[model samples]
Target: MQTSPKPKLLIFDVNGTLLNMDGIKTAINQAYQHPGAFTQWFSWLLQYSLVDTVTKTYHPFSEIAEAALQMTAASLKVNVDAVFMQDILKSMQQLPPHPDILTGLDLLKKAGYKMVTLTNSASAAQKKQLEFAQLNAYFEETFSVDAVELYKPHPKTYQYVLDELNFDPQETMLIAAHGWDVAGAARAGLQTAFIARDGQALYPLAKKPEFVCADLHELAVQLAAL
Candidate 1:
């Protein structure tokens, strides 16, 4: 088994990493009247987030989600209006964490691991999301990519967190459900734990994550042992 020297800081990715987006998926399906619109919308949201990063354009995550929803609605020949998009955005803030989250996070907290969240969601939305999910107590800090005007998968965003927390890359472990995020942290020099949520897969060319667990519960046990 691979064992890491216990890290000084554990930085988590929000969204699908810590929180469940099943509600948002249901919302999309209901609004678009299409069973597959949810998946397509999420893919487009992530795609355009990177597009903005690569093209030097910046928009808050909520805006990107809204735009993605409109595009998804249009593609499906569904006349989803701005009001429906706004409702979706509001629902996003109220999502619950995955079922494994509470026990997993509690285990880490009890073990004296310092935890924080690093998210693409901007400050206000990030706070609301965490608070709504009742996850605010587990994290010591919540960071957003907006601080550096770059999103995850960009080295600057990771560096910004490390810099603010006064921790070296080697002293940190980035825990995420997205392979692209794990790849980014690996490139930035942090150890990574990939939570292989259903429908998520690692990139073939990306560096292997130092740890791979089926969910946060499994990850918690491994981290506690370390």
Candidate 2:
């Protein structure tokens, strides 16, 4: 690990890191009523988001999610119309914060670390999510890939924040629960910390983040020592 000075800002990935996705997962699983529908749909959501970036196209994250759900429905021979798919995805807007989110964010806030959000979701949806989760108050600013019409793990997305937010890459830390996210930040020249949420791990081929923690609370504890 590299010894670095404290960061000026913390960039967070909202979907699975701060906001728990369990509610949305349950909604998808129940709507499809299949054994692994949620997992499959979620995997496709991620794949299509990256596909959007590679193809140089952009759509709101919810649209990609609905498309993924459509694919899952077809694969399982379950028929669902656009309205039903939309209804199922509304669960995403209502996801609750992780149990330790308040404590973790509060610690960072009191310690004088500036915080912000960088999400793939559209600005409107991101607002709804944070409001619903009651986590909107902690962040100083919120960013969406929509600003640049790109998705995460794309260098431009990280760069956009650095430019628009006027922060040095070395002075920003991207904290996320997904391996691809931390890897992306590391390659972007920003510091990173991997929150090892359920079933998440680091990519062996990518530059590793400076910190690997079990959750945001552990991240606070670890950063406190530094």
Clashes of each: 0, 0
TM per candidate = 0.97, 0.95
* lDDT of all predictions: 0.92, 0.89
- Predicted model with the maximum lDDT: 1
Compared with the true structure, what per-residue lDDT tens digits does model 1 show for residues 1-226?
A: 6666678899999999999998888878988898899999989998999999999999998899989998998899989888888989998888899999999999999989999999999889999999999999999999999998888899989999999989999889999999999999999999999999998999879889888999999999988987
- Model 2 CA lDDT for position 106: 87
Clashing pairs in 2: none
Give the local distance difference test score of model 2: 0.89
| Candidate 2 per-residue lDDT over residues 1-226, each given as its tens digit | 5487788889999999999988777767787888699889988999999998999888889889988988999998987678878787787888889998899998888888889999999999999999999998899999999999989989889999999889999999999999999888888999999999887889999987888888899898777666
Model 1: residues with Cα > 4 Å off, grouped in runs:
none
